[model samples]
Each structure stands twice: as C-alpha cells, then as structure tokens.
Target: MAGEVRAQGAVKSGQLDFPRPLTTVDVVIFSILDDKLQVLLVQRPAGEGEPFPLSLALPGGFVDIARDRDLAACAARKLKEKTGVTSPYLEQLGSWGSASRDPRGWSATHAYFALILADASTLTSDARWLPIRDGKLREKLAFDHGEILASAIQRLRNKVEYTSLPAYLMPAEFTLPDLQRVYEIVLDRPLEKSAFRTRILSADMIEPVAKMRRGPNRPAQLYRLKKNSEPVYFVRTFNPPE
Candidate 1:
C-alpha cells in the first residue's frame, strides 16, 4: 500500500516499535524535451500524512517480492504503479538503510532515479511536472525528497559533461546543436558555440536524419541518439567535486 513502511525485527523495549518488514524506493524522474528541465511529482492523496489532498511527490512504493523477482525490478514496478508508466532508464541511486529512518521500526529504502520525457498523466502522485528552478517549486515536496532531488541534480550535472546521459533525454535523432543544448542545461552554463560543437562532434555519438526540420530560412537536419553510445570519457572523482 501507499501507507507507512512496516517495522521489522524484535526490540527488547517490549513495546512494538515497527509493524511488518519494510523496504522502500525513492525515484527521481527527469525529462528534457524543450527549453526547460523538469522533474515529475505527485500530490499525496488524503490521509497518508497528506496535508494537501493533492500534493506533489515522486512515484514510489514498498518492494513487492511476489510481483518482482528482484529489488530493482520491484522498485521499478512500484514506480510504474504510482506513475502509470514504465521507466526506460532506471538505476539504483543508493541504499538508505537506517535504524530509524522510517517511522516504522528497522525500516530501509532503496532510491532509484528514472529518466523520461516531461509529459502529463505519467508522474506518481496527484501528478505535475515541475521545473527545476527553485522558485518554480513552491510546495513542500514530501519525504526527504528535498535531499533526494538535490542529490539527483548534482549527480546529473556531473554526469553530462563527458558522458552520454544527455542521449537518454533526447530523441533518437537530434542535431548536434540540439544535443549541445541538453549539455548546456546539464552544465547550468552555456558552452561557447564553436567549442560545444567540436566537443560533441568529436565524440561522434549522433548522426543526421534522412529528413530535415526546415526552418524559416533553411533546412535543419534531425539526428538520432546512437546505440550503446558511451561518451569518450567520464570525469572520475571519489568525492563530490567542489
């Protein structure tokens, strides 16, 4: 259910600390199809500490061993249940195992991040696609979500500079300029147009489309994401870069 996580293990305290066994998933969904970078959120229905009858949150749930063969698949299934769509790029964010992170005893959760298009009717909660800008998000995102969001953003920004993650958000075919924009968005700063072009072109991950997207003056070609397209290199840092 979408309620509290169940507590597990025996406590010498005598009083029952938590109820049943507990496990959870924290999902971070993002899409970049246009000018904006947006994340999916859902409103909490009434009665699950839901102050707002409809408030924003990520789609997630308890692990269902019966339905899913493994933890990752279980989390993915829960995400689909809550969001109404399947995630194309899902990965383990990290394990959140704590003695008392959950109100229920001995509870733990596994967080996962999903990358998808920013569209309607697909997010988990009451559902809304919120822009990444701080002011754009006024409502309180639920359950350690603030932290989770921050982590996902930092992780994404760091990944895009030299990695192919940008491909995850772009169409199969895209122009070098289009791919560059996604990179700029991730960097949170503009890259010199010429240098940007060289960076991606040299990587050689994208190709031109058969047809072009004609513009006001001339024809602009469309391109698609490459297969198994790993960027030339990744920035490695044991610690978060300053």
Candidate 2:
C-alpha cells in the first residue's frame, strides 16, 4: 500500500530514497545590556565525539517534527528554551546549508533573529550575553554561527536606519531619550535628537503611557509600543548627525 511506505529511507512515488541532511533551527537573540548591543550565546557541552564541544554557539537544536509546526515555531521554541522569554520581534533572517558546515553530517539551519529587553528574560546557566563590538564578535563561534551572526547584525543595523526595529530592545515603559539611546546603541552613531524625536513620534508606533520617568533634570513622559504594533518604516534612512 502507498501509505505503508513508512520505513526510513523508503521510496515512495516521487520521494528520494537517499538519507536526508541534518535539519535544525537557530536563533540569534539580541538585546541591549550594559549600554551595549549584546547577543545571547550558549556553550556546547563537552563530550567525546561531540562536534564543537565547549564552544559557544547560537541557541538551537534539531527540529522536532512532532512538536514544531513550522520553521517559525521551531525558532520560537528554541529561543524560549534558551532565554525563557518569548520576544515579540522575532524575524526570519535566512537559511544556511552546506556539507562542510557541520562535522557530523550535511546540515541546514533556518536562522531567525529576535530582539528583546535584556532584563525581561532569565537565561540558563550555560547561556550568557556577549557584547557585539564594531559589528563583529571577538571570539569565534562554533560551526557557521559566526557568519550567521554577522549577517543578523548587518540586517538589524540596516533595518534600524529605516524601520522602528530598535523599539523591541526597549523596556515596557521608557522616555523618548531612552528610546533614542537604544537606537544609537544599535546603529553605532549619534542621531540628531530633534529629528529622531520627530520621526519616532510621527510614526505612531508608540503611545504615551500614564507614567513618567523621573530623572535628574525633570520628569520625562513615558511611552510604550502601541498594542499589536508593527515596526514602522520611514520614508528615508536616518542620516548621521552633521
């Protein structure tokens, strides 16, 4: 019977009989911490015959076909397992696949990037935040994760110039200055204050909350991302200050 072809490597009408490559989902989780753009990385366990043991890599694992409904579901499951926080700003970055990329076998990984408030999550013991310096990592990552991470960072910085993506890095309530600082941290340059404020407020991505953040000078109005808000794209990229 056609439905009886359930054996491993079984040949069906148009299905290939060869073994499948290793399939997995990887997430590049980003957050702002210590006034710097940081990424969450997990250390691989040390074991005999294990690939890249004791090396730091992005949080990911093999796709559980029984559990995950799709690529995005697998990404979210991996992210939540590692960070204990489900971010509202998860995006599909890209997919990387090659025989030489993984030592165990030919593997393909669907990579997703997420932005969350640093203080909103509790990381497992093996996971830690590492600062991204000058759009790169100082230490090498296991597998092709270094390349994946670089791509994620570049995508993030590029989008930040024209989209309200940085708002995902903010806490629940914050002042306009705080929001601007987060943008500057991700973009690695100072944005014009007046222009930044004008753009952010006009975009209608955020709404004024009832609270205020009291500072040394005076109380500043607090704002939160509007309910069910999506990142707002600007007409032009934000140019650096003159």
Residue 1 error, candidate 2, Å: 32
Please provide TM-scores, in order, for all candidate models, with all chains considered together: 0.77, 0.93
Superposition TM-score, candidate 2 onto the true structure:
0.93
Off by over 4 Å in 1: 1-21, 48-55, 82-87, 119-125, 134-138, 229-242
After the best TM-score superposition of candidate 2, give how far the Cα of residue 67 lies from its true spot, in angstroms: 1.0
Q: Give the winner by lDDT.
A: 2
* lDDT score of residue 216 within candidate 2: 85
lDDT of 1 by residue, 191-219 (tens): 67786666566667777669887778777
- What's the lDDT of the predicted structure labeled candidate 2? 0.90
